[model samples]
Target: MKIKFFRTIWWKLLVSYLCLILITTVISYILTTATFRTIRIKERQMEIEIRVERIARIIGELCKEDEKIENIKGNFNEIARISGIPLQMLNPEGKVVAFSRSSHPKFRQIKNINLQPFEMRKLREGKKFSYTQYYGENRKKLYYYICPIYREGNFKGSLVTAVPLGLSRGFAIMLLNSVLIATIIAFILAVFLSRSFTRPIRRMGEAAQSMAHGDFTKKMKLSRKDELGFLADAFDEMSSQLKRNIESRMKLMGDISHDLSTPLTTIQAIAEAICDGVIDTEEGRKKYLESILNQTRRLSFLINDITELSKFEAGEVKINKTLFDVVEPIQRAVESAGFLAGKKEIQIEISIEDEKLQALGDMEKILKAIQNLINNAVQHNPPGTKIRISATKEKEKVLFSVEDNGQGIPEEEIENIFNRFHKVDKARTSGASRSGLGLAIVEEILKAHGEEISVTSSQQGSRFFFYLPYLDPASADVFLDK
Candidate 1:
């Protein structure tokens, strides 16, 4: 999708970077210019003071002989020419005595230089002073430095020097130009840097769009170790999970439809045949009715299994855990499956490490799980095969195992045996009445109890086992209320 320039991350980042650079540039320029001006002014003041002191000394020497002020006009003019600054000699009364010649028109117009009251006071005290004043219509600044002249322990007149206030205009222009160049360079870099930073995000956005369209194959190939890379990895994982779930859901729907439709079609056909009087004999009619009844029962069982599995998957099934004798459930499950085992001519053997061993879990669910495992062994094995059911205490847990000496499950199918509607090869076993949901129910029940079931199979037989925390009866009082 096309995104607006102003709303994009690149735009925001670029604007932020440029704004920072602009603010920094402006602040740096103001500070640097101010500092440069202060240093230049101080240097100029020192230079002017040195030159004014020399002129004061010259005036003092000339005045020892009581020479007139006009006689030293030539000296003042020469000093002004050499220093490129205007000069004025002031009497003790703060009036101009002798002034220098200058090429500048503004300085030539000056008839007299007046000193402030403070300046006069400082000079009267035989101290030097300096200050700044603006002149003319433009208000141009000029720096003034005055040195007191002394002769024979008496205060002579003061020597004054005046120069315009500023640094070199060429250097100032160069400094400003340098700052502008740097700002332009930084702005250019901000564009590239913002683009580099936002490139991965744009790619991820596109990948998300593809996912929205039901395409889960997009991969973000980013290798960075930053947060963005971590997000990309998570996104990739989510996509893979979504793909797997979608595929599994489709397969499950197909399995359910097939399983349900087979019995439904059979029941429908048989009912129609009986209604049409295809079997009018008493024995034939009774036989067809029995078949219909069996199909109906199969349908009911399938529906119930699907509903219960859904409850488990949706986390709607709460495990009501309590301490219960593990042996009681084992015996109950074996007895419940005795009729089915008898029909298959299978023999069940039970082995208990301790009859009093108790496990912590919902007793009803645990018994149901055990019953499913025992029935699965009976239904999947050949006639006359032997099944061993056992509960043994090891460490702090009770291990329940069921092993059947029948044609074992194939190695490749072992991993998927617990999946819903998954069945083994029919030609290798005898029973065909199972709905293939028994192992799946067992797995979900154990999982809800915070336990896992594992199976090991060889040419001899297959053994399914799981562990539950064993509860000591002495400590069972604490959990009795739960």
Candidate 2:
């Protein structure tokens, strides 16, 4: 059940934070307890040393065998009371001679828990100046300390002090109450912190979901200058761009429909006029009918291009890969543009040196892309200008390009000309080009075949370029078998 955490970043962040806090708390607890115990032991032992030293000084001048030892024994209890600890004194023979406590709690069994007699005898032979131990005879918890006493350069007795291992009742209650208060305060702060961190994330997530559902109207909210804020701003920019594209496509579709309808209406009206004898002469009627027919053909061509573009963009178009000669197809495309070239008095030329230059790709789409580029060059060229188409085998790829010595594209619209239904200006297009789907259709088809296409235009002229996979002699023959 614990193995499924790789699904997202937030879960990992929460787990990482939990682990880091727990590890830090454990280390802090260990270090704090060690320091506190060392401090407590040192404080208790310092007071014991002072008491033993004073007693040694008082009894140091006493001559032979005085019974003041009883008075001195009572002083041990006074030291324990003043220092907030219990005292157990052992003779040099290691017997438990005395013990003192004001009151014992009900949970304690005082009499059954005592120090071992033999353990004290080894300590009193002028052995340890001071030491400490925990636990008692009945296995109850205690902290026992031993200190040897001296008088006139002879061993008098030993002091065994035992402090309860548990905290005092009042202190224990106070610490527990403090912990409860701290926990409540920390939990409230934690809630506020969690909200501060997750609120921006939630807002970003909702905006993303709306974009996924094709509603690009909403923008992400951002409040900070961190990575999240940068991400939010980027997302907002993406949404604005997407909204503009969607609106443009809708407007273009309406324009395309109107263009096609107007052409068809002209053709229909011309046919009706000819049938009704509205034109008195046959020659006049024939010319009007031919003009209407030309517009009808243009509408048909535009519809076919739009359909191909949709298939390509939707990834529904299939590529039939085969080895084919690149030079002949390019020549054919230029020849097809001869009429437009003649009308503008522009010369169309094709240059190729590699007769065996072969490319593996869909020949039909390649032909269409070249045709569109040539048509663009022809339509946009001034009189007496020249356009050229060329192909060459470069390493593993076949490169094709169409170049025109024309007024070239404007600096601003060169990159955007391939976008769906985008045009630089209304005055610069053919009569039917308010739809503006030419370059977009060309780009989509080439892209579907895993090919690259681009255009560059400057004062030197404009070049439209693309590439296809080059196949050698043996590989080209192998393709012919399939």
Candidate 3:
């Protein structure tokens, strides 16, 4: 399926960062531009007021020297040329006395300008007034400053100065260009940072998709020392486990078919021979039927073992708990298997550190597990071999082991002995217990009790051992009746 640009993590991250940068740039531009304009306006206003006030004081001093019109015009023209401010002198009655030719044409065209009532009052009170206006075709800004000239507390005339806005349009243009450049830089950096953060997420999504399609061999190879790295490691572990499970399942099916077919094939042939009267004697027919019965029993045993192992693996078996002396079940299993051992003249013995060593677990399952181990030992051993069953206390638990003086398992097969349907080919043909689920079931029972079983073997013998938790002494009172 095609993914939309907006839905992908990389695209989303890039867009989000771009939006944030654009917003910040806009806000920064607005604030900075406003502040700069404000400062420029304030500076222009102050310069106009100071220059006009100084001219007013100079005009007052000149009025004291000579009241000649020609003299005042000359002085005003000189001051305008030097200060770069357009100047005009006005009589107290609001008539223009002198005007600088340096002033804008619009200003020279005005013969007289009456001040507002409030403005005139301010001038009469020996104060100055300032205002701004736009003039000319280009609508350039202009600042007007007016102050009353005084000679020894006597008002002589008003001094007026006009100053054009000092700041040029070029400065604003430069500031705008600067903001644009900053925005571009910020956007580039945003893309880089966003990509760095979202790259891992993109890889994870791809890996997940691959896994969904039953591809367990793919692995995520992130090297970051963060949560993402940990997630990658966990994903690899899960993939490996899944692969093992699939392989084991396939192998189990094949083993089941091969093992089950052997007995059925034998039974079919033997029964067909008897039915066809191929055995000429009645005794031969009876022996053939007995052989068929043995095969039938073997098939039943195999099926039962498979079913029970499945229950144990699925956690469906409920253990009935009780407190019992550990020796009792071990002794019981030995007694049950003694008849078979006697046929081979093998002597089975039992040893205990304490006969009364008690454990908490399912009694029936424990007895069955012990019997399977003893039967295995008897089947594998030569005639006159000695089998020993021992139980001893080990701190808070009891250790039980079955040891046999028989040809030991090879090192390579030891690890797989407890795997379901795992059979030693040599041991099977040597007339050892052929059903391969015995040790597997025993391991499952131990696992259900939260214990583990181990084996140690050499050419001389093999020993299988496991630990069972001892019944707590303080809780023994509760089970005194049993």
Candidate 4:
């Protein structure tokens, strides 16, 4: 269970944060306690040293006045009483002479004393020194200091001072309690912060699950300015894209069904009419058969275009690139689409500012794109309309255009003209069997070639144009001569 708990990021983060705070608090407690003990001991030692030196000085002055140890013992006892600190006087032979307890109000007898070897050595050296010792079953600790007494350069005795080790227990306890309380508060804050941080990620995970189940409506509600915030933004963008793709695909399916059914229904009706002998004349029958064929061809064209466009969108179509005369394919497209123009008595005009302009691209796809544009122009224009095809070398690229003197596209509708299944109003496309995929396919093909197609239309006419990279302008004369 502990292992499993640690495996979760929430628990891990909480534990990590808590551990960090706990370690810091523990270290601080140790340092604070140690420092307090050091400062308190030093203050106590300083007070003890002053008291001991005063007693030693008094004893030395009395001895100089010819006062014996027994005579000065009473004076030492009185000095210890006034100082309010436990003190002992040891003879030169290490025998106790006087004690502060002897003069205490509760006990009027002298207290016994024992000196360790190191302590005796410190006294003999007449050096002031301090040390800690523990006594009794509970090991109550005490800080002891020794100050030496001397008269006429002869060691007289030592005055010792003792103080309980704990001088500020109340302050120490308060500080410890404060640190512990702060640590607890920090742990609580860690829990809340970790949860807050991971909440958005958890929500995002659930949202992703919903998306996987075909529900893109669940969105994360997070507004933080961090890496996590950026991740949330990306997740929302992905959800939006998924929703759009699904909706657009559904609409495309419906459009495909309607478009397919229209041709199929026409073919079926024509076949039924011919089979039932509704058309008596053989010429009429032939016309009906041709109509069926045309419908079938139209159906085939739509399906093929749809399939090819899907491949192009999916990045599955490979372009075969080669350097070719830009005019060659445009010229071919003109001649092929000329018949369609001739049907409506539309004259096709061609122009080339640089006849030697060569471009690098897939010739077949480029030809198909040019033919699509020319067909679109021919179908939309009225009889006796003029459609102009022109190519010119501009800087490092060759600009190709197809302009038609027909009813132009509206400014508002221009942006979506290249969208699949998008068609202008029927008034602009009368008598044209437009699957509405021609311009879209052209756009995709040109895009695959690292190019773009755009349009500008107004009251006079509509011009569709794009640029292709030139194959080396310096070799223009060589290509022109070819």
Candidate 5:
């Protein structure tokens, strides 16, 4: 169970989220603790300074009474009581003159030392003093402040008040506990938040992995209307398109194989007949060989068409943006279709409102695309059927259409006529000299250059229309097939 959980993305996401929350919480706790500790120390120092100043006023007046050493000792007791802390006054000779607990015998033995930096500066200026960290006779830590007791603004003995930071230490410990508790809470929240944030991304990753494994059925479905949502929608669209392309390619392969197989099978029979001494005339052998060569050439053309379509799709075939006469490429396609028209006894008619209209695109590919449409109309029509070619410029776009007065496309299947390998009748399609990829190739080539190709038909005839973005005559390539 543990191994399975570890292998899954959702579990991994949850664990990672928890870890992030804990890390953030720990950082916050540390920062808060440090800030609180600094505040506490500053407050303790201020309290000690105030106590020292209060005691100094009484000591300076009493220390001047040369007759009352014992009275001064009693005054120190009063100082300790009022200050709410230990009070000790040191003389210039490093002897304790007045202090709480002065009767401890070691108090007289404990030696006074030079004042710390803050204390010495205060003493030199005859002002109140402060010490941030001080040590006592018993090696106890204290926060202290001192002041010079004075008369008539004259320097005298120093008065010091100290506070054992036992309470402050306890407060610090309490703060640490509070910080730890808060950190734990924050860690939990961070984990939850991080998991929530990463859930969509993780799903996307899974979807991508699935696609890599050739499963393009699932879509990334994120409900958020942010950038993630847009990404999810794009991913879904990509998957669907990928699936469709795969299906189309598979269908094309099947159709092409079926078409090629027939000719190949016939060639094998003809070869077997020649080996078995069935054909005696040189002309009959020549005809059989020519038929095989024709089929081979047809296969080559189909392969070339597929390759060119892929190039167009990949944008490897650059659209040569030239403003030339649209009539030029149209005439080229019409000329190419003439041979097929002649064979079928089909009369192709052409009409144009403006022959000088131009469009921006690759002329070669455009001509090929146009040729495919015209050839299709000519090939499928009855020998006497009239095929029409028309071109017009509309709103800065050029529309070229090939119409045929032949067996019209069925209403049900016209929509899919341009699909590769799709046949109105597979048996009829098989006998046809060309592969069924003609219109499919044309459609793809047009789409690659950001052009539009569509088919509309009625009971009378079918019209195939394609539009290309127009270019000004100044920029168009002028290819006149004179």
Candidate 6:
């Protein structure tokens, strides 16, 4: 599908990356400019100080030769023009004895020179002095360096030099051009990175669309080890699980229709046969009526099992837990299935490690789970098969097991035995009442109690076992009182 530009993750990631880069570039530009400006100003101040000292030494030499200021004024103007800085000759009394003429407009506006008291005192003491001041409408910075000129070991005067620290127009343009070029390069890189970041998300969206249309074959070929890779792996797992569930549901529907149709067709046929007088004799009629009744009962059992499994899968079945002697339910379940086992000549052996072993769970459900397991063994196995039922105390829990010595389950079919409507022996026609939901329901009952059931099978026999939390009789009473 063609996604809207602004609504896609690619567009959003691109915008976010560009915004971050832009902000970083602007901040970097401002800080860099400020830092370079400060360094340049310091360098200029140092250079001007050296020049002022040179002029001071020259003036001292001129004083030794001639104390008259006119003799040195021509040299001062020459030095100022060469250095492009204005110079002033100040006496000890803070008066400008001579000053250089400059072509610069700002220097021309200087009518008189007034030194600060501290600066004059330092010069009189034969030491150097320096200060900075701002001038004009733009507040341009000007640096002043004053060094003492000495003649015959006595302080004669001081020489001053003034230079502006304003940054040049050419330098400012160069910095701005560098920043613009860097920003363009950064934005281009951001575009590629954004595309790489959003590529997986786009593929996942396409995969989801394919899944919606019942196609489950698409795979994301990302091989990254980051969070995006983890998310992609999770997506693939979800898709696989969804496909399996859909296939399982389809199989379950077919199995249910087949199971229900058999009993229903038999009941319909028997009823119609009796109605059409096909069996006129009383004995034949009675036998046909009994067959119809049996079919109806089988239909009822299948519907009830299906409903019970639906409730368990939907989490509609609530477990009402209480502490009860585990052996009581085991014994009761065995006795209830005694009639069926006797009919099939299946021998059931009970082995209880402790008759007083107590477990915490819904007693009725536990009984039903045991009964289903026992009945399953009897119906599936041939006559004379022996089923062993055992309950034993194991540390903090009680282990219950049912083992039958018969043709064991195939290894490949063991994994699917707990799935609803899955029968190990698909060709068996003797167990007409079996709806194939017994093991599935048994599994659900144990799961609702926060336990798991496991099976191990060999050619000799198959054993199904599960554990339940055990409680002593004294503790059971204490719990009931609370």
Model 2, residue pairs in steric clash: none
Please rank every candidate by TM-score, starting with the best.
1, 4, 6, 3, 2, 5
Model 2 superposed RMSD (Cα): 6.8
Residue ranges of candidate 6 with Cα displaced over 4 Å: 1-26, 59-67, 72-81, 88-102, 111-133, 145-160, 271-284, 325-331, 347-359, 386-405, 410-412, 454-463
How far out, in Å, is residue 123 in model 5? 18
Q: What residue pairs are clashing in model 4?
A: none
RMSD of 1: 3.4
TM-score of 6: 0.82
- lDDT (C-alpha, whole model) for all candidates: 0.84, 0.69, 0.82, 0.81, 0.72, 0.84
What tens-digit string does per-residue lDDT give for candidate 6 at 1-482?
99899988889988998899889989999998899899989888888888778877776777753465445677767776786678877777777767777733554566367888887887888889777778889898877778888877777777877778856779989999999999999999989998999989899889989999999999775798999899889889999999999998999999999998987888888888888889889999889888888877788878988999999989999999998888888889999889989998898999997777788999999998998888888887789999999989899898999999987889999999998888878887436568889888999999999998899998888898999998877677888777
Q: Estimate each model's TM-score.
A: 0.86, 0.66, 0.81, 0.86, 0.63, 0.82
Steric overlap count per candidate: 0, 0, 0, 0, 7, 0
Worst 10 residues of 5 by lDDT: 102-111
Q: Where's the lowest-lDDT run of ten residues in candidate 6?
A: 103-112
State how far residue 468 of model 3 sits from its true place (Å). Answer: 1.8
lDDT of 1 at 316: 98
Clash count in backbone of candidate 2: 0
lDDT of 4 by residue, 93-139 (tens): 67777777734321223245567788788777878787777765767
Give the least accurate 10-residue stretch of model 4, judged by summed lDDT.
102-111
lDDT of 2: 0.69
Where is model 3 more than 4 Å wrong at Cα?
4-6, 9-15, 50-64, 68-71, 74-88, 92-113, 116-144, 147-156, 161-174, 180-203, 425-433, 472-474, 477-482
Q: Which RMSD values do the candidates have, in order?
A: 3.4, 6.8, 4.3, 4.5, 7.6, 4.0
In model 6, what is the error at residue 186, expressed in angstroms?
A: 3.4
Query: Candidate 4: misplaced stretches above 4 Å?
Result: 1-7, 58-64, 72-75, 102-143, 149-156, 164-172, 427-433, 473-482
